[model samples]
Target: MSVIGKMLTLLRGSARELGESVVDANATRIYEQEIIDARNAILKAKSELTGVMAKEMQSAREIERIRAEALRLEDLALEALGKGKEALAEEVAVKIAETEQQLEEQSRVHADYALQVGKLKDLIKSAEAKVREHEREVAIARTTESVYKATRSISDNIGASGSKLLNARESLDRIKRRHEELADRMAAAESLDKETGTRALEIKLAEAGIGGDAERARRVMERIRARKTDAEGQ
Candidate 1:
């Protein structure tokens, strides 16, 4: 194919795919609409079937009327023959034959109507059964779609919550590390202060001649001086 033709084909494919995607997305709605359409069709068929049945009944009534007329004519022909009227009886017999023929034709028509009505009824029944099954399937599809949406929402929320929990845990860990570092610094500072304070107090005592080897040396020197002066005086 030429480039333009290929491009057109690609566009057509993409369009088809897009259409299918949209249809799939709204499949449940479409199925429900289809069920409604099927029900409407069944109702229309039933109405038509009712008309056919009415015609069949009318045909049956016509047949009965013809049969009654034939019976009445037969009785009239019998009375005419009993009264010695051959021509009138012959005329009555012709009417009886005509009525019988009419009855036969009406009965055939009625039978045909009855057959059509039966077939239509069976077809309508089967169509209704199929529609009912489709309705049930649509119901199940709707329920399943709802369940899938709920599950998807829950899964999305769980994923988001999991991320948030991870962030919170990291923040907690950082806080703990900072607190531990601060505690260490404070402990080091406290130890250094104690060492510095003790050294400063010892230096002050030594300068005031109050505590250590220097004071003991001064006392020994004073005792030696006193003994020498006593020996010279004696």
Candidate 2:
């Protein structure tokens, strides 16, 4: 890959890793928030239940008052008849009939309310039991969150330390490369200096008349000594 393309790839990889690390590190907080939300939902449910229970209580009291009024009307009608007041008795009989009708309708309504109250109670009981059970779950979740948080914290620290180490290693490698280059340049400079000194010395020797002929004479004498030495050995 091109240098820029390679760099972009590295950046993308690093970003992805960072995002994953952040999510892992914060998972505990997310779970804790969820638990809080669940508790809040239970509180809201109880609040609504309280309102409904209040209305139910009011309705129960009203039913009782209506039932008591019906009883009173019946007693009044019987008393009127016992007093030998026929017209009064007749009037009271009509009132009793109307009261009885009202009582019947109220009773039907009260029966429905009563059944609903029982169901509401059962529902509340079930919900409370579920909430209590969920409390245990929440407690366990809290412990899990703590464990995950500790693990994530250690992982994050290790990851950060690894990144720093990688950067330090890269920097050390670059410094080593630079030092090698400097050493190469210094070696080249020293080699060039040696060559220049050798050439200058040869020029000076030639000026002093010792460049070629004198060296050739020395080689000739060396060959003569080699022949004599070989002849003696034989």
Candidate 3:
């Protein structure tokens, strides 16, 4: 491939990887937000279902009222016929027919609305179940994500602490070596203290004002001599 083509290909690959990383980082938040949106949808559906149910209830009452009116009209028509009033009976018959027709029509509408209510309720119930399942799954996902992040953090710490650990180990070894060297020197000093000529050497070294002042040692020696002289004189 040409250099330009290769560069373009590399750029595309980099972009794709970047996009994927961005998506992965935000995936949990996106999923949580999506669950929230779904819950909102459920609420909206429930609201709509409530409206449908209310309308269904109104339709039921309407059907009941229509049936009652039709029964009253039937009784009026029968009474008028029994009274030997032909014109009145005819008018009551017309009213009865109209009422019956309306009752039939309203009955059909009421049944349709009843069916609709049932279907909506079932649909809402199913949606609610699905939402609950998603909620559980999202919770699991979140927990799993947390665990993964924690593990990743620990791994990163362990990896990055390599240099610090190495340095600390080297420091400890150096301290141990130094301690051993100091122990050897202390042992040598003790050995020197046991030597036959070491006391005369230490006196000379002390008189040179190395570890303590020669003037202080002379003053201490003078006090001891004076006490001896006083005892001898007594």
- Candidate 3 Cα misplacement greater than 4 A, ranges: 1-30, 159-234
Task: Locate the minimum summed-lDDT window of 10 residues in model 2.
Answer: 16-25
Clashes of each: 0, 0, 0
Write one digit per residue (lDDT tens) for candidate 2, span 10-37: 4467544443232232544555566566
List the global CA lDDT of all models: 0.76, 0.67, 0.73
Per-model TM-score versus the true fold: 0.56, 0.41, 0.54
Candidates ranked, most accurate by lDDT first: 1, 3, 2
What is the TM-score of candidate 1? 0.56
> For residues 26-137, could you state the per-residue lDDT of candidate 1 as single tens digits?
6557767877887888898899898998999899888888888888899999999999999999999988888888888888899899899988888888878777766765
Superposition error at 167 for model 1 (Å)? 20
Cα deviation of 153, candidate 1, in Å: 0.6
* Error at 131, model 3, angstroms: 1.8
- Residue 104 lDDT, candidate 1, scale 0-100: 83
81-153, model 3: which lDDT tens digit per residue? 8998889989988887888888888888888878887887787787777667656655654554465566667
Better of 2 and 3 by lDDT: 3
TM-score of 3: 0.54
- Using alpha carbons, what is the TM-score of model 2? 0.41
